[model samples]
Target chain A: METRTQDTASFEVTPWEVRGKVDYRKLAEHFGVKLITESELEQIRKLAGGELHYLLRRGFFFAHRGLDSILQRIEKGQRWALYTGRGPSADLHLGHILPWMFAKWLCDRFGVELFFEMTDDEKFLVRDLPLEEANKYAYDNALTLIAIGFKPEQLHLIIDTEDIKYLYRIAIRVAKCLTLSTVKHTFGFTDSTNVGAVFFPTLQIAVAFLPTELYREETPVLIPAGIDQDPYFRLARDVADRLGYPKPCTIYCKFVPALTGEEKMSSSRPETAIYILDDDKTVKKKIMNALTGGQPTKELQRKLGGNPDVCVVYRYFQAYVDDDSLVSKIYNDCKSGNLICGECKLILYEHIVRLLQELRERREKAKDVLEYYRISTKFR
Target chain B: METRTQDTASFEVTPWEVRGKVDYRKLAEHFGVKLITESELEQIRKLAGGELHYLLRRGFFFAHRGLDSILQRIEKGQRWALYTGRGPSADLHLGHILPWMFAKWLCDRFGVELFFEMTDDEKFLVRDLPLEEANKYAYDNALTLIAIGFKPEQLHLIIDTEDIKYLYRIAIRVAKCLTLSTVKHTFGFTDSTNVGAVFFPTLQIAVAFLPTELYREETPVLIPAGIDQDPYFRLARDVADRLGYPKPCTIYCKFVPALTGEEKMSSSRPETAIYILDDDKTVKKKIMNALTGGQPTKELQRKLGGNPDVCVVYRYFQAYVDDDSLVSKIYNDCKSGNLICGECKLILYEHIVRLLQELRERREKAKDVLEYYRISTKFR
Candidate 1:
């Protein structure tokens, strides 16, 4: 139950939802967080060209840093790898899959090796979880990741803190490029515990460079994660510049929202999100409760219309169920009062059921399928 | 640079040291820190018998915890090991060798494995040495340690923090047994850097258990260190008890007095102590400037006599030269005004030269000794 306060501000505009103090660019500039300008974003769209079919429109390739140079390198046939992870705090939720799926897609799209860290050390230093419990959580989470159809050859899943410890010494060398003050400034951590909690972002940076140093030759990395995770790679990119390693490019998409319509679909509240372990009834209950802005009546839609943009279900359609024309048609009809909110939610509910049924059944049959150790350690 | 206050009130009463506001037993007892009482310590001595030597004349190893059971097991022919370190801050002074020499003797007497850590991590973290510089210091320091003539098959050396991180993870688990409140209370550190700084004590504990775990057998350890370091190991022994691992026995020796007649010989002040690396000229200069308890004149010495018990040069003979009978002969003759202080100082200076000459040569020529690496890693 992460509460959302919209952080009320001054300006109230007429007819549209633009507000005061809500300038994304101004906020980004204020914080020195480099964001893609409209022109740079257009350049990305033009550069992606045919790749946009699988990338942009479905929101697969969203946020980025130094992406233009990355694309130029890719165009010149320079390869990049993948970096992603899970906190393993609770059950794996829809929020967790967006990044891993993006990373998996990038692996197929660009023949890149993927490194998935379990970050159990992070949990060890931060959470009160027992080491064995953290280890078990990592093991279980790895299985859930495998069930998502990640190619065995491309992924290296490291769950142990010890493995990461030797790995972190290298990471700290990169981390040393940034001061604790600088880190604390960006992270807003006030205590020693805060430093321990934030230690993984440095490790995340090392994961990008590890392929080049640990594997054989230099391998660049492409991190696919939530927009919330962009700051980690931003620091990674900064550390790379100082440490003389290739910077990791990132594709940070917004999270797939929960049924309750929030910024994130957290698993702490089970009612708002569907789990891979969820049965048909549970999935149905969650989807039916999902928020939608489709019109309740044709006359009301013609009079007041639906705010399809703010709807959580609409956001999901924009993220996961990636049929562009179908979603666009649904959006237009709902906005024009042709499709009602109830009918639209019912359809999306069925789409999710058909989408996840086979995966759930297979997941139930063999819990051991996820425990494939070779797939984890060797990463093929 | 250390001065000992002449306070007969405490007369080596340890339970209340350093201002008496802190409760030693109550603080230790709160975390189930097993506090072996004075009687319990005597029981442990009975069980250990002649296997472990105490600095009894000095009252250094007064505090004990779980030592009775460990020594009982040891007397019954159960195995144990030793753990110690070299900071490589500078060349080893007489004070540095006091612990290692005693440790080497214990290893010989008890037939236990010894682990010598070259604490480059601690040196770098605590002091201002770069990793490369710290490593070079360790490399150089290893030669001096090898020059001490420790057995090749008993000591394991770990210098790189990068290598030690995972092995340290087990120790960090014990450290996790401690809270920030506990560690801060013990160390009085107020920052994140303090955690890594104070972690060496935990590393020492892990080294104590290495034979049992790493060698894959059931055994304990006896950590031989100066009394100043005893405070740190008290916490380590506490962690061992909590983890169901055997609590390590500790041998706390009194400090070897500086040539300048201070309470301790410190490497920090060049004028105060003779270092292993000191040449004949430097050694002579240090001894000539050394503080003495002897009277300035023949008239005063004949009238007041010398305080040989507090004489720094006399302590040197007691710590290093091994011929206690010769030291007694000189001590008794000087106090009676039969021997002059200058003549005594000259004799002590020559003993230093003669003592270090072989070591300097061995350290200089020991480069070709592949045996040193074996000794360092305890592989031979």
Candidate 2:
């Protein structure tokens, strides 16, 4: 069965950037995540009018699928829609930017209509959360997302508890198009979890193309997400093509690393990643205690400086820093013993601390974020 | 451990009714369905002031959790609502009247709001129905239900395929409260069917109380149904109670049997049941072929003319005939070797044929029934 093959392939491939030190080239092919070729990157750069500097290359934006076609559409003045979502687990993480940023990029370049899903209902079902608590979490998550500077007029956000009939209709149609074997294989569920878990994949696939389902005109979507979730989007792509809609292209960005560099930058593990609400002291401590490639003693570090390319601090710079030229300069200077790990780490920490604070302030003033979320329906 | 016990309880308690001749009383108890007591029936008759001929027996309505409370509140002139639904599976069968009749009783008695869910979308997902076909069935089913004499002003119908956003918000929330274990156990799925199948129970529960989920106000509902569906209501009861809302009471009536003296009547099996659309000649042929308890020859017939108690035609008299005195006369004459099976069957056949002709003619004029299905939030 196709399901079994995906399971076999998921195991064999998907080398999680565990410890956050991933070989970008190897990861691209391992997950079957489409990546821009040398020419494709050049084309993307040209499409941006030499604005390649805004990208997160060597950071999290690692893979692509049919990304070139979307670019071609943009070049031809044809619009595309942006589709992406968050699970609304507990809190938002820097790793969450992997998809949102790419979605933002598509929106800016192609004037794509964006649909953002706050899968709070799904989180509650799978996580056994109380409805009130789940709803609150969804609201909080939405606020944080709005802070990220996604264009309000192009977005559509939904929470599961707000209405129910829509879910049933979408769920049934989704369930009909797919099968048990497909979902069981995709989610890797045992005989224990509920049937809701099995039937949930269709909702995800539906959310990825919800705009199309809502209107007479079908629109193809571009789903931007992290490499960890490549399988889900791949399933979405499969459902899309099968449903007589064009498959959604994926930009499978790499995950942001934590202080421990344990393949992901998760808030769940406090040591690996910093939260948006973290104070300056906590942020500094995390970065100071973070695992690094610098030699133990300062004297030894002065003699052997640091392998900046291998350091966690440098890794953060590659992901969050806006200045690519400065990062490249730091990398070269550190290799020649001109830059120290502690100093480079401090610089990275300062950038992240500033970014999170600025984001929080911006979120506070985001006008009628919920209204903004509903704006995507116009295109549909 | 709790999940396992609940699943086992569901399997042991739920019972689907069989056609021809079901042990309905025992089946109702096994599934935890409510049934009226003889004492209750006596009270209903007394309350009716001997006008029992107009209403379905009041005693048949039992297992109410909030009906009495809702009624008392209504008497105090507190606002309340009535909820009911129809599965758009096929033409509305005579069996579907259990819920409508109950809803009519509630509205007339309490002056409450009435809402009807055209479960076309639910059918689409579970039955793999096309969207247009699903809508068509809803329209067809609605007209038949309306012809039963539901007032236009007192009823509100919802077809899920229309106005997706608000409805989806409600369905997914209910989906979150449910688990696959509950859904699978309810549906009798054991490592069979998809997650969509598991997810379906939640949708039914969602429909059972869409108002409260949408408005954040608890609403009491009485779901009138064939006793066969008690298990589903039992599931709904649990969900409603857990959600801090009132569990719906059930007023389940027994199914009407086919003319063949089978346990249950099935429209698909034409020989087993009389359909609403059956013409005069077809109705006559079906009645003549109907199973009877009479002697084959004249010599034997003189000894045993008929046992009307075991005859399908006699049961029809018990269900449809307006005059109880006439019913008793027919039974007495048959037992006393006066009324033969052929003559008794003809009388019943004539009554049903007349009704069918009038019903079918009206059904033909119920054009554009879909116009009544609206997604408006306002009651007026």
Candidate 3:
């Protein structure tokens, strides 16, 4: 219901609205989810047979429902799958990849299948964007996922509009369990909301459980997505048992912050969002202008040090920096006044530039292999 | 807007709700369409190259928008197409075939195409019926339409869930023009209505104009359906200009009254509705029990003449009796109280029994050639 920034402003998060400071712990309480604990991370690390993912270790994916059950199922040698999605509303930004990045890591770590959905139909229905544009965005976003190096055999990229013949059959089964009252309660739908928007949660829920239908068995599913998307899963989980499928478990992630630190990174705000395809100069410029935890005056900053807790740059470092030692040094230096905003920005800019350059090259290569990721074959 | 039956309780008519005494003229006014005038009927007769259809001549098809324009376009050597649909919520009954029968005549007379849609998705969405049941009903309904003798080459049978890929693209375009406000206003939809119900108008609109899209030209279109369905076309016509398609013309038919002389023939009321698949014994039983306008006393009936206008038996004779001379004889005999309710019921039963038997045989024949009428091929 509400996401207050830990040390700053209070905010609210819905699939359509994200504002102010997002207090993950308080947000978890409001959403009625358990915060992912140290023991859970240790269990996942053990299952993965390696160091914990930087996202989990750094508390990016910090809350969950039924993570314990999913882990227990996995420990018992039952296969578990990953479910995540993107709404093709605009160009992909760094924030868009946060859940997907974690999803890919989970698939590799556990050798399980992944269901990646592009909700072009939802965007076309809810947004004023043309179907043509929404379809193009779906393809572009799929390319971004492919660039992250998901194995072709392990991943199933499902575009809603393209594969609806399969999805709609299952979607109708899900839609039957949902009442107009329930969708209105969950999504804040009103008399003026288009019918497509009202019916969309069913499609989202269908994809979450589609793996079980495909495998002809109940495979434990883990959805790693923004906390804003929790309402859809809540509705999905509510209806899963009635539809004779396993309720999907979820690991809710925190919002990857905007450059301004005023809200989550959004495609609509070009100045605040560092897009995946943003050139080196643009990325650097955005990082340099980003709001950080440093004091206004250089002298004041030198004496009191910066608040790494409120820094957007530190959040990016926490998201992308793999080495724990390097992440700790960055946080300690910022808090001890050993690092300045300009120096820290330059370091983030260099790291992001190298990362994006590799991704851009990989995305180019991904164009040729898109057919392999399409999940239509699995349905047939 | 309400439809109060003359000398009966008032009823309401929306696309979703049909009740009360349906005043065709008032219903026309409420739906913002003009009653089809005598002159328009004459014009249609001349275009049809003989006597007008009994439905049109009798004012059963009594309301329209753009009928004159469609006639003019046909006169100018341009083609026109027919569009009509059924929501597969129940078994097809006599009331369901009135429009399709008229549509078949239109296609034959005009040498044009017909797009017959089966809204199984809407049924699955709106009703508690499962997809399998809805799909089965769609097939059953399709067989009945095929039994009406629509030329395979001239008719394109479309099933919504099966042919969604083609429909959805155009539906999205049609949906873009519609706002939540307009659909709510047109269909009397509430917040509590399912989203599929909200979005279904777009699909209906898509099928209405599908011929133009397939031929890649602006072919004039005509819709013949129960007056209850006029609201969908009104919304579709409102958005047609912006979507660059010609506004569809419609001829709204009155509901064939139920056998009990109450409301319309409804599949939900099995005793009142004579289904196409009903056995001979069931048909005879329903007709014998039907309410007629005969006097309570035989002597009083001979003195004061019966009311043919209020007789359900007389209405059925009006619908089925094709010969003008015979129809006049039946009307005159009923008004003069010379024809007893028993004799009229016998005559009506013979006509329907023959009609149903022929339809059943044709329906059985229709089962094998179903693939021929499917429109999915055209889209590919």
DockQ leader? 3
Worst 10 residues of 3 chain B by lDDT: B1-10
Per-residue lDDT of candidate 1, residues B132-171 (tens digit):
6777788787777766766566555666463464355566
Each model's lDDT comes to 0.62, 0.64, 0.82
Highest lDDT model number: 3
Q: Considering just chain B, what TM-score does every model have?
A: 0.80, 0.82, 0.95
- Please report, as a residue range, the 10-residue window in candidate 2 chain B with the lowest summed lDDT: B1-10
| Candidate 3 CAPRI level | acceptable
Best by TM-score: 3
lDDT of 2 by residue, A71-162 (tens): 77778876467877776756577777656766666667657777777766667667666656777777777777777777667667766555
User: In model 2, which runs have C-alpha deviations exceeding 4 angstroms?
Assistant: A1-30, A53-56, A68-79, A163-170, A214-218, A375-380, B1-20, B32-35, B46-84, B110-115, B163-178, B211-218, B277-285, B293-304, B333-346, B357-380
Q: Show the colliding residue pairs in model 3.
A: A4-A23, A5-A21, B4-B21, B5-B21, B10-B20, B11-B19, B11-B20
Q: Report the lDDT of model 3 for residue B89.
A: 57
| Lowest summed lDDT window (length 10), candidate 2 chain A | A1-10
DockQ (C-alpha based) per candidate is: 0.20, 0.41, 0.42
Worst 10 residues of 1 chain B by lDDT: B13-22
| Cα misplacement distance, residue B235 of candidate 3 (Å) | 1.8
Sorted by DockQ (best first), the order is: 3, 2, 1
